[model samples]
Target chain A: MQRPVPRRSGGGLARGIPAVLSVVSAFVIWEIYVRVSGISPLMLPAPSRVLDQMVQNRVLLWDNTVPTLKATFAGFALSLTVAFGLSIILDFMPRVRRALFPIFVVSQTLPLVAIAPLVVLWFGFDLTPKVLLVALVTFFPMLVALVDGYASTDPEIEDLMRSMGATRDQIFRAARFPSAMPYFFAGLRISITYAVVAAIFAEYVGARAGLGIVILNAKNSFRPDIVLAAVVISSLLTLILFSATALLQRTVLRWRDVEGHR
Target chain B: MTALSLKDVSVTFGDIPVLDRINLHVEQGEFVSILGPSGAGKSTIFRLLTGALPLQTGTISCASPENSFAFMPQRDALMPWRRIIDNLTLGLEVQGIPRKDARAHVAPLLRDFGLADFTTHYPAQLSGGMRQRAALLRTIVQGRSIQLLDEPFGALDALTRTQMQTWFEDRWRAARWTSLLVTHDVREAVALSDRIYVLSRRPARVIAEITVPIPRPRLGRPPSAQAHDIEAHLLEILLHQTGEKP
Candidate 1:
């Protein structure tokens, strides 16, 4: 019989085991504290109760999660497209890079909470406002990473290219773009996590569906376990998105390891 | 025919002239080494020849029929993202040579340079000697007749540098291309070149053109005292140029 390949456990799971244990321990403590302290179920539910609620309202939870996932994915896609396009434009033009960099920085400073309502008012409670909010939150980091990557091109390598009669476009394609992959992936990882949070925040302000809406409905109905379930689901979603970005990074940057230097 | 000619060539960075009204010529297939101390403007000559720097005054031109030139800078300017083969084909690719065609030419060259296994490896993965060899291969693969090398093996260790010197000599002997190398190591210049040009410091000018009577394949120990004497003479001129000697 052929021997099966020994499967390597993902570092993420190994690293996460202790964290999961700590969180479960903390939740157990919270459950005990709530029970002993005479806190009403409406005020705070135990971890067991939250798990029970999640099981009971699995379909309802899925329905709410769908909207949030839709908004997050849509907004993230838009943000990625916009950030990538803007980075390329800025990279091509030094004057544009210098002129727009401050504007991009200023965009990040505009508090999303303040802008969320305004976006809702302007674009209404539809998907447009939610996407705008997520895009606004996620764009800066990607843009900055791309710019840094472009700037990080080794000058000596660039000189070599020039001496070889490489045109500017040739140099960028051969060196600058490849060199920037790590930085770009790093930015994407950061922004993807933020995408989920931004979408949730936007949904919290005004939304017909989404985990945010589910949490708000649970809170209004005095169902603390339902609220906790929604929170857990959202956290899981964020983790999934983060893991996916990491996977993408590994695939794209596999050549970097082969190159010897990071 | 002269491969390269610099007639009254002067290069000034702002008010300071790094190479002042320098005149030199390298005949076709001749190996000439520019020997001087650090900051002797030996590198500046290579830079000017390679069009990295513009001549401030006078004409500097290559007279070779092939006219094209390749520069091997002091640092191994290999792109970390590119594989060894891709790095070697970079010049050809840039010059509008199709990837398939470029690879066809570069594949054999990599094998010849003992870098066939490393074709898929990145520059970061290679050792100092390997990187230098890869860089040289890249320069040669460009199909340039004139090679302007500025301390191509300067960053390598003594052992690796010696190894590279032998590799370079063997390759150059086979290729029979005109090469002008700028180096601080006297023995390296003496071992590799037919003639050596000694330059003065700062506002550098040719102090002497010392003929290296030493035969090829200068292996084993270092050269004799007579070789050191010529090196000392060149060093003395360099030190005097820098005003280190009265």
Candidate 2:
């Protein structure tokens, strides 16, 4: 006997109520805290002032955001290619996995804050450093997730594939790779959040234009509202990227999600 | 000539022996079962036969090539992402059959397998018996002369297992492929197998080779006294292997 799969009743908008409520409550609390604490605009701009500044300087903010977005996407794309390549190679060659996995772990331990400056020193004030920083920060998690995914393949399924006269590549394409999709998306969700932040951090160390530069400029000019506006914009970009990853994961892995009800 | 034969097959893991000089055979179109309690190296034999594990010291000869047998493991092992039709046609696809041809080949068989309507459904959407039915169909559509079934009904509940045992019997009788089943259940062995090879625990060896001479369609009527005698004798041998009184 089997348990019937529970049908999903509400669509996205219906299920989005709790999330909307939580966000509204959080914003309300922040607005109240700023007004009651009587913080000066220079020290901690009220939510209303930050919102006003964001609207007034939307053009300037958007102009700087273009560079940060480009760097993040560039680095994220590079990281995806590298991680996919390495994970496949390492999965096929256990010796390589053994030799390189430790080195990758050590690479992650190198703090991005420390490494970003050095990367900028070498790559200069162009987009390369920011892109490299984003790639460096996001690579290991996706690689680890993929490697573990490949390793965790059901041996029985692999054996079944082999018994059917499937070659190594056939087994990989049919069983190993498909099984790893969920883990890949999960890794992407985690790494996507880091991509934008890493880009901003690299820009903070050195950049001609970006959200990092915008924040740095606002800070130098002692406009806390503008700084907070940049901060809000950067965070919004992260949220947007994260939500996009989640939505993509849901679409691709719609089959797996049904296992929850089962 | 026998459809498949294993002579002096021995396997060891590190210092521990798993199967020792095991020999068995299946005649063409025969329903054979290797019966033993759990940890009897039943799965080890399967792995060796399927070429997943190295055959340490024995010779395994089959009428067809190594890949000529379709295997159904203990778990359904259905790809959750694929629909029932896709899962059924996986073996054909892996053997270089194009998806279109594979689908066309498997589509007609789905109705006989009682999975015609469920072709578009995912594995998660099927019942335990239905999933196993689909798995069995998947193996058969591989166009293999021999089928290796490793406890195909082991995961089902007792009631479903009984129902499936009969259902599988009917299917086997109709298809009549050279089939080898590995299971620990004695009644199942008596009910389904034309011949049963009772095995000892670890480092498995053939303890008894009992032929079930009962007539076909053994499920509809009460099992004959001859079937009971065979079941009892097989159980006694199995219990003896485990150092127990039957």
Candidate 2 local Cα displacement, residue B124, angstroms: 0.8
What candidate 2 gets wrong by more than 4 Å, as runs, is A1-5, A9-11, B244-246
Model 1 clash pairs are: A259-B125
Q: Report fnat in order of the candidates.
A: 0.58, 0.68
In lDDT terms, which candidate is top?
2
Please count the clashing residue pairs in each candidate, in the order shown: 1, 0
Candidate 1, CAPRI quality class derived from DockQ: acceptable
How do the residues A1-262 of candidate 2 rate in per-residue lDDT, one tens digit apiece? 4456667777979899999999889888988988998877798787889999999999999999999999999999999999999999998899989999899999999988788889999999998898889999999999988998887789889999888888999988888898898889889989999999899999999999999999888999999899989999899999999999888887888787667631
Candidate 2 structure quality by residue, lDDT tens digits, B1-246: 699999999988999988989989999999999999899899888888777888789899989865668899999999988888999999999889999999999988888789987887889989999999999999999998889999999999999899998888888889898999999999888898899998988878898898888899998679899988988888888777788542
DockQ for every model comes to: 0.43, 0.67
Best by DockQ: 2
